[model samples]
Target: MFDVKIVNGHILDGTGNPWTKLDIGIINDTIVEIGQLKDAPSKETIDAEGLVVSPGFIDTHVHSDLLCLRPEVHKIKVMQGVTTELFGQDGISVAPVSSETKPIWQKQLKGLNGDIGDWPWESIDDYLSYLEQSDLIGNNTYLVPHGGARTLVMGFEGRKATKEEMTEMRKIVEKGMEEGAVGVSSGLIYPPNIYSDKEELIEICKGAARYDGCFVVHIRNESNKSLEALEEVIDVARITGVRLHVSHFKVAGELNRDKFTKSLQLMDEAREEGIEVTFDQYPYTAGSTVFHSILPPWMHEGGTEKLLERLKDKDVRNRIKEDFLHNEDYENWVRNCGWENIVIASVGSEQNKEAENKNMLKIAELWNTTPEEAAFDLLLEEEANITMIAHWGDEEDLIYGMQHPLQVVGSDGIFGGKPHPRLFGTYPRVLGEFVREKGALTLSEAVRRMTGAPAQLLRLKDRGLLIEGYKADIVVFDPTTVKDRSTYEEPLLEPVGIKYVLVNGLLAVKDEQFTGMTAGRVIRSGVATPVN
Candidate 1:
């Protein structure tokens, strides 16, 4: 007898093809059959009469590095139909650290990745092993973080790495890949990573290339110098022959919106020249990240403690204000999108909790000070543990990017107080608004982007497709009524019309309610074998 049988559903199969009426049979954790199985005996049966059955969605970018350790909080992803996620994004995460660098990274990443207290894991192998032993709500994978490696070798210094340091960093990356990292990632706008030049990046990409791993990057500048940033990574990919994946690709700011088309042209040219380039984008005009990211990179040279010290000095604060106003060399969020467009999303301290969900301008008015001063005080009070959402791109640009042939869906979701609505609504919004309402893309194509495309990119041998003998990770939902209920004003609301979700042949979400089952596995690169 089969372990479970789901019958009478229209199967999309995650192949970018039209749906076919079929039934799926599961035995243990594998999809045993996918044809006529209505009369087949099974231990359990699900009647999915009018639902669409497709492979469970894979989130390409997420900040769930520590959150995954807490399934109660991490189930939000499964509630939205995401059964797998890629972590170690933006070149900062919770692995491959020396004991000396652990506390420093912990403090620097508290705003973006919430604090989970001290753990005993240091290397990528240790971290992955910890996940394997944890009660995970979904499958998790990781990329070796560039900043983590840099800090491990040299303690957050902002100078160019010497030849010996470069060799050390490269070896760290190679070890991570050997320990089962799918790729290497760098956030060029963040500290330590920002200190790296093109040569450093080339050396690092070569390490990833040795294992045929992708080089995923959040390029240095996404505003006025976006094209140059894109070209910089493209050139690295060219020189190192590393497969390249750009993270949350966009041209931010009103003045830089016109550069969106040219950015796509560059990507197309790169692909034409035989670079395996792809990108993931959230379907939104506003982007969210740590509030401290708005400051100049130089200010973050020595780590969070040093950054806080600089923030206390009057002269340093003034220099920061000047740089925010006139700096084109770094990403100047204040100059591109004013303080009015930057809204505080989360703060760590109880004293600063009132600032959450308020724009910097509003908070400034409430404090009777300039917006810059208000932000500085908040960062100081919260110990730089704050996050913000900035309204940057246009809806038209977002749609155009979504329609690109190489584009895939990623929520870029960060979990915390008054977080971005995309955290709760990205997948549903794409299905309901982009597909059912505006017809921007067919439902099949949308599912393909969320499923098959990311699977191909990550080189998952058996996941991301609804085929016989594959893992039974699947989602069942209604196309007519699926919609995202979360908004910027009410960001915690869950979605509607996701009927059921299954992970590893077991029901994780049955009839729209989570079953409290922790059946997830830690997927290592090139280690997953197809279930026969």
Candidate 2:
């Protein structure tokens, strides 16, 4: 008798193989059999008669970096059939921080990761071990953030690293890999990381590559300078012999939207030249991040407190505003999308909570102040503790970019003040709109993007595929009924199609509801799972 039997389903199998009618049986945490299983005895039998069973979605660029600590992790992720996810993305995260650097990271990363009570986060291994030992809902994977590595070795100064400092940074990357990171990641627009020259990044990637890690980057610019940013990462991959992956690759702003094809062709050309590269993207036409990220990089110098001090100084504030006036070197997200399109996604305090889901212009009117003054004061009051979703993408560009073979699915998803609907709707939306409706990709192709492709990148041989010996991480959904219910006005509504999800053979979601089974594991690079 099998522990759990899923019967009469059309299986996609995550391998880009054609859908085949099969029944999958699981015992403990591994699939015991795959084929006809009529009359099979089991503790549970999921009737997947009209469902499409694919491997549970693997979200490769999630900012749920700290959600493993709370029960909400199950609610936000497992309900959407996300059985595994990559955290520590975009180069800023909590691991590898010291007693002194912890405070700085908490402040710098406040927008991405809210404050945490006392938890042992001294090293990347400590953080991973804590998750492994906890009641986590999904398999958690991590990349050593280059932002944290840079801050630890050189502080947040906007200057090139010395040779010795570069060596020290390499050591931090080496130690993070020993702690079991799949790779290293960077946010080039963020502080300290912005200070790193190409030479420094190459050295960082070299260090990560010694442990067979890839470099996942949030490129320097995605708007007007998007092509140039692509060239920079391609250069890193070519020169350092490192595998490269772009996090949420997109061309923003109306001026550069048409260059989308040229940008992707550049990556294709790089592959022809033997530089390995791939990219991830969400289906939505909007993007989310810290509200203060739109400011000139110089404004983020020193640290969050110093930046807050500058924001309060009228002269300094005016000087910074002039950069926006001149359309300076910075990739100002607000200017690219227009201030009215930048809506408040989250806030730091209760008093400011009323501004949640409201745009900057709207918030300004409520405060009886100019939008400029309101933006500055909001940053100062919250210590730049705000996040925003900018409605900045072009539809043709989005569909074109997502259709490329190099593009895989990732939810640059976050949870906080009025989060982007992508957080709740990414996987289902692609299934419903892209595959089921538009026919942009077949079901097998989309499943491979979310599953087999990423599992190959993470070097997980057994998890992503739904073969007999693989781990029992699976999703069952109705192709006809699967649809994303979340929208801009109501962002947190659960998706409608996924009926059941299992994490390591235990039911995490059944009948589209969480089953309170936190049976997920922490996956580290080069760590072997006993497969039979």
State the local distance difference test value for candidate 1. Answer: 0.92
lDDT of 1 by residue, 1-532 (tens): 8999999999999999999999999999999999999999999999989899999999999999998888888888998899999999989988888879988989999999898999689999999999999899899889999999999988899899998898889889888888889889999999989999999999888888888788989999999999999999999999999889999999989888889999999999999999999999998899999999999998999999999989999999999999988989998899998999999999998888889999999999999999999988988999999999999989899999999989999999999999999999999999999999999999999999999999998988889999998999999999999899999989999999888999888898988888998988888887322111
Worst 10 residues of 1 by lDDT: 523-532
Question: Model 2: per-residue lDDT, tens digit, 414-504?
Answer: 8787888998999999999999999888989999999998888777868988988899999999999888898888998999889999999
Show pairs that collide, candidate 2: none
Single out the weakest 10-residue window by summed lDDT for candidate 2.
523-532
The candidate maximizing TM-score is: 1
- TM-score attained by model 1: 0.98
C-alpha RMSD values across all candidates: 2.2, 2.4
